[model samples]
Target: MPTPASLVSPRLPAQAAIAVPTSRIHALRTGARAAGLIAAGLGMLGLLGGWLHWPPLATLGAGSVPMEPNSALMSLLCGVSLIFALRSPQSARRSTCPLAFAALAVAALTLSQWASGVDFGLDGLLVQGGASPPPLTALAFIALSLGLIAMCKRGRIHTQLSEAAALAAASAALVGLLGLIFSVQSLGGETRSPPSAVALPSMLAVLALAAGMMSARPDGPVVSVLASSQPGAQFGRRLLGWLLCAPLLAALLQAGVQRGWVGGSSALALGVFIALAALAAAIVSSARRLNAAALHCELELGQLRQAAVVFRSSNEAIVITDAQANILTANRAYEDITGYPVDELAGQNPRLMKSGRHDTEFYRMIWRELHERGAWRGEVWNRRKNGEVYAVWQSISAIRDDDGSVTNYVSLLADITSIKEAEARLQHLAHHDPLTDMPNRLLFANTLERSLAHAKRHQHRLALLLVDLDRFKRVNDTLGHPAGDRLLQVMAERLHSKLRSGDTLARLGGDEFSVLVADAGSREEIAALAGKLVANAAQPVWLEGRSVDTSISVGIAIFPDDA
Candidate 1:
């Protein structure tokens, strides 16, 4: 059986498949070590940079500039975090060393940034401005963004940490936004410190955006992992993760600016973070909705399959045709009735079932009526697969498309052979007498009427002879009705045999009958035919091993003049 197409996503490239597992382990390990280094750097940066102190081994003995040591710590923080991230991709969280390390490193960096006192604007961006520090901070965040995107996309690690990635994105945005706001605003009279404090939070936001994009792959393993998260309900849990980080980062940025970080505005960075977090939350919510929808669609698919099976197995003969009157499908009953396999019949002309009993005009009339009335329910003769013909009661209708175009045709048919036989029997009952099996008074009257009308128009004589048996009732009384009926049947046969084939003889009832001979020569010929009816009908009929005699009294009537 063919596998359902929807069940699987297309395979990733070979490089993508192999590189993910290999690189991610190292990346995670590096992330751990890097986080530790960055965290320590953050603590030092917190104590020394915020105070603008040039440690004793400081280059050129720091004053307001706070050279070398401050720059060294900031650079180290960025570098260590990058290493942790770079090595962490080992397909995704292969070893907790990398994941836990990176998380702790970032957390340590966050706390250091928090501890640094938000009033730091000492790098000349605030009271005394610098030439390249602000531009450098922006450039660094941009580069980090690009690096994470390249790694996540190429490694295809989004599948490994779906929930975490989404939560991470939201958290990053909040931190970035809050940090930017707090860093840009100056509040209580406080000693502002250094440029790197404000810049750190912005770097984290760029990382968060990369992680968000990575986790969006439809079949990525990240989703399976996300499904395993706790401490949050299905919808709100993800949003909650993000909200927790924003306020802390915001307060830190505010404190950092008071202590003198870069004088540049932090507001823009904070706004970017908020936007990113909202977007990430939206993405996760949409994914859950889609999964629910897919489940519903799967249930509907099963019902449709069951319905198809039912349609195929129905016992009533059903034929479905294209608009052009070609077979499209047929059911088991159709095959049973026509002795044709549905597979063999599909794409063949449906007209193959038409027997030649009807002429062209007859079929045209049927089509005309059907098209006009939207349906035709009547009897027809159709051929079986073996060239045998059968009578069927068929109903055909047009199947229309939404645009009112006739797209198909459907027919339901059943065998009516027995019904036809019953109809023939009814007709025999109407025209002939039951006891004698001869044309009855009703048939003789019809024949007389037609013959008289034709004779008048053609200037010819027509005659009718009334027949009565002399003693049919007495025979019935003596020999029983069975013998009497036999005598009547014999008399009817004799009268029929004695007449010319064109003449008609009928027993009206009991002893009564009528003979009709049309286009007669004259009264003499009419008299002769009537006399023969009397003589021949006198023959005895055999019944139960005995002979019963029957005689007739005939009254003759000639058309035009009763002579």
Candidate 2:
């Protein structure tokens, strides 16, 4: 759980927050969604057109006029949605309405159109030579309808909307054209006139929406003149977006002529569409292949997330700073251990946790090491969220970028309070006798060496005494070692309690012991402590079964003066 400060206050550093601004993201989303709706609408018309012509509907009912009214309505709705979509590129909610309309249009057009046309007893849905409108007239009408659409919304354009609308229109056109060609043979090559009625309306709807949407957007000479003057000019990336649908147009021509669905002028127009559609499909496919070839060139990201998750959940104290020695990021763990909210310390220095245990020079050394090596792994004294101080064993490292420059610093730390207690226990064990729980021979040796050095340097005197517990073996054999050990522990305690702060005592394993009296004025002072030790051991000690009395014999020597 994070502290209140961390939860309520600001988080995330200044640099990272600035890199991804909210405004730019919103603009891109609006633009992209508008573009997508346009694409989907065009696709609906093409597919619906292909079905209407290929399946061949001969006048089954009075309603079977020129073209399917439902498809035209769908194309109209798609155009309308696209116009509205100009405002929100990133939004899916607004785009769905148009998509639904286009879908409904396709469904109604397909079913109703299928029912309207009649199937011939022989050669694919063939119509007699003198049926209704000629095939060429229908094609020309579709083109005229699309041109009218372009005219209505030719007010103005900007690079963004122009690029978006243009791309959508071109793609939709190719799709609708291809679909019409594919369906031509099924509809009755010579008699069917549905394509003619549909072409003008569908194209008009598309062109009108593109013009309306583009005009409302901002414009520069580049976007306006380039698009308004040259419908086929290559400007910036506009050409690429337009080129995406080229293959669909070419496919339309192939279905109509190579397959022999239409004749003469219609065939030539179909051929042109076929050439364009083939190229578009090829380009989309080629782009995908090229991207696959350079997959490894992209840098691997997202690995940092796993480690960051672990750091957030951990219970140890943590501190995060930047390459500039200023703290930026911290985690929940830091809040839990320090009683500070993560946000309170964000963008601040690590002084928030200063325990004041070490001097400035000590910290300077640590900083120097970190800067020189790009990492420093060691222990440091840190203050809690409150004023208390604690010892922490920490590992700190530099976070770097691809260019090998340090960006931030991360620290992982653990508390070591129990470790300090263990050290004191080990020191006692080394100096004191285990049986007596008092200072031992090793401690006496260390004290003697120190005393000798001090006496040589400052003309000081020190005293030493060695003692042996008397009649302890008889008591041990009779009452067991437990009583003997208890007697030694009791005597060691008595002598230890009687000693001055400067004095020292040791148990030489079993019943033997020693004492040190430093800077002794005379022989009598040293002898006096030795005599007191022997008398203290003579006191009675109580055992479960019996009361035992123990005594010790003592010897004494004074440092420098005695030597």
Instruction: Give the 10-residue window scoring lowest on summed lDDT in candidate 2.
Output: 121-130
Best by lDDT: 1
**lDDT digits (tens) for residues 1-563 of candidate 1:** 11112111113354333222323433444443544354345435533543554343222222222322233333344334444444445632343234334433433343344356443433333112321123223333333323333334333443334334434544444443453444432122223453233334223333433343332232344432333222122444465455555566555656566687733376447646775977687677867776876787799789766655666776777777766777777778788889999778867997788899888987788778767876777888989989988888889888664345565677888988778889989999999898878888788788877887788788888787888889888888888988877777777778888888788878777688788887777888778877777777776777778777768898877777874
lDDT of 2 by residue, 1-563 (tens): 33223322226543222221234334434553454355345435433444555222222222223223333444445455554445444432445344544434344334344356642221122222212222232232233233223323433332443445444554454455444545432222433444422343344344444444444332423333433322222232355455544545455555566667777588677666766775676567656655654353232223334555665776876676766757665677667667778667766787668788888998888788887987777767778867777777878888765446676677877787568669878888877676766667787788778877987789888777777888888988988888777777787888787678888788877777777777777777667766777677778889757787777888777767568
Off by more than 4 A, model 2? 1-310, 313-318, 323-326, 332-348, 354-357, 383-390, 399-407, 415-428
Q: How close is candidate 2 to the true structure, as a TM-score?
A: 0.45
TM-score result, candidate 1? 0.45
Candidate 1: list runs displaced more than 4 Å. 1-303, 369-374, 385-389
Best by TM-score: 1
- Give the TM-score of each candidate: 0.45, 0.45
- Model 2's number of clashes is 41
